[model samples]
Target: MADSVQRAFDLAAEDYDRTRRRLVPGFDDFYRAAIDLIQFPHDSQLKVLDLGAGTGLLAAFIAYSFPQARITMVDISSEMLERARARFELAGERFRFEVSDYGVDPIQEKYDAVVSALSIHHLGDDQKRSLFARIHGALNDGGVFVNAEQCRGATPERHRFHHERWITRVRELGVDDRDLAAALDRMKFDRAATLEDQLQWLREAGFRDIDCAYKNLIFAVYRGIK
Candidate 1:
């Protein structure tokens, strides 16, 4: 499963960043909500980890918002991380990369904040719960976990609504048919849990101040404080 995901992303690496904004209809506020919820001041020199960082788009947002942040980006696709490396080339030692399956690998270090975008939903429900616990353990006392993710709806009808609404919105945004088809194909690996379920899992993982900061169709930004 991991190998298949890696291969799919490797093939898309070149076009990932370009289509990202269009593919995600909620691009503007979805990412902004995640960044704005980070409970830190601008000048704090903090350690941040980005799971499934992809081409480091989310990390780029953080770096711009928080200049003193040092980031570690973990992703299963080397091709994607290669793009991320180029994106952060002049940052010197401020950025680090690890190509590993975050699901099976240990976070291994404490961080001030941990963030992920359009990832994590690839994991099964059990895996999501376990990873939430691991994420909780990997954070400092005041650290926060911000997940800008795709989530399932609370019911079957709602789920269909979410899917249809997304397709409609993206087409309205003028994404070409080929690009839209590819995006839908890659989403086959997604195993999204409902927002309520994920919030409960975060609570079980011993996180506090849990909140769904933003929601737009299937897109959401949820946060938890340790």
Candidate 2:
């Protein structure tokens, strides 16, 4: 399943940004909301780690909004990171890129802020929980973690509804039926937890002041302070 998931994104990497930009109309709005909710230090140097930083979408926003921040963009897909690296070439020394699996990456350093978008849903519940703990540990005191995620609905019927809505959305974007089927089939193998459940897991992981800062159906920004 993991190999299949990786392959799907790898195959899509060449056109991922273009396809997403057309399909997900509100992509920038989501990123803006997530960024607005994050609290950073005024005069101190800030280090930010963007997990699952596909194509450097959110990283670009972070760079523009917080020009002084040192940004590390991490993802498991080399192809995606390659594009991300290219996107920030003009920034030069301000940004860094790394190919990493967030679930297994060791914590040698702490960050002032950790952000992810539309990525963590690939992991199962246990992986999600463990990653949250690792993220908490990776933070300096009073640091923040913000995740803009694809969440599961509260019930089976609601899940089906959200699934159908997403299918309709991608279909309208001209994604072929075959690709959409394959994607949905792969998702069926993994467990996507509800927003409430994820918030509870965050609390269990020793994060404080956790909340869902934004939501549009199954997509939400879950944030916490360490």
Candidate 3:
């Protein structure tokens, strides 16, 4: 399953960023809210970890926002990482890449902040919970974790509305059929949990000051502090 997901992403690596903004409703706010949750100073030389950091989009935003932060980006697809590497080629050692399945890989180093965008939903419920615990352990004191991700609606009615809104908005944004079909295929691997369940899992994992920073239908940005 992991390999399948990796292949899907690797195939889409070249054009993923171009299609993302239109495909995702409230894309700007979702990413902005995630960046806003990172409490470090702009000049702070913080160690940052980006989980499932495809094409390093979110990491690039963080780097632009916090220029001195050193980032380690991990992803399951080397092809995706290659794009990220090229994007940050001038950074030298400021940006590092690792190819591994974050679901089971050991995150050996501690970080002052961990950020993920449009990822994590690929894991099953149990894996999500265990990953949350592992994330907490990987954080330093007062470290923050922010995830900008898709979530299942709380009820059947809400789920229907969510899907409808997504379809309407993406179509309105002029998303081409080819990109839309590919995106839907990738979603087959998603195992998104309800926003409520994820917050509970974060609490169980020992995260304090947990908050849903932003939510728009199925898209949400969550924040937690260790």
| Candidates 2 and 3, the one with greater TM-score | 3
Please identify which of the two predictions, 1 or 3, would achieve the higher lDDT against the true structure. Answer: 1
What lDDT, from 0 to 1, does candidate 3 have? 0.93
Q: Show how many residue pairs clash in every candidate, following the order shown.
A: 0, 0, 0
Model 1: residues with Cα > 4 Å off, grouped in runs: none
Better of 1 and 3 by TM-score: 1
- The alpha-carbon root-mean-square deviation between model 3 and the true structure, to one decimal in Å, is 0.8
Clashing pairs in 3: none
lDDT of 3 by residue, 1-226 (tens): 8988999999999999999999988888989999999988889898999999999999999999999999999999999999999999999999999999999987899999998988899999999999999999999999999999999999988987997899889999999999889888988888899999999999999999999889997899998999
- Could you say which candidate leads in lDDT? 1
lDDT of 2 by residue, 1-226 (tens): 5665566667667777766653453667777788876777444478999998979988888877787889899888888899998898888887888887776777567999999988888898989999999999999999999998888998989988987887787777787766666556646645678998999999999999887877766678879999
Candidate 1 lDDT over 45-117, as tens digits, reads: 9899999999999999999999999999999999999999999999999999999999989988999999999
Q: What is the C-alpha lDDT of each candidate?
A: 0.94, 0.81, 0.93
Q: Which ten residues in a row have the lowest lDDT in candidate 2?
A: 18-27
**Measured by TM-score, how close is model 1 to the native structure?**
0.99
Where model 2 places Cα greater than 4 Å from the true spot, the runs are: 41-44, 170-190
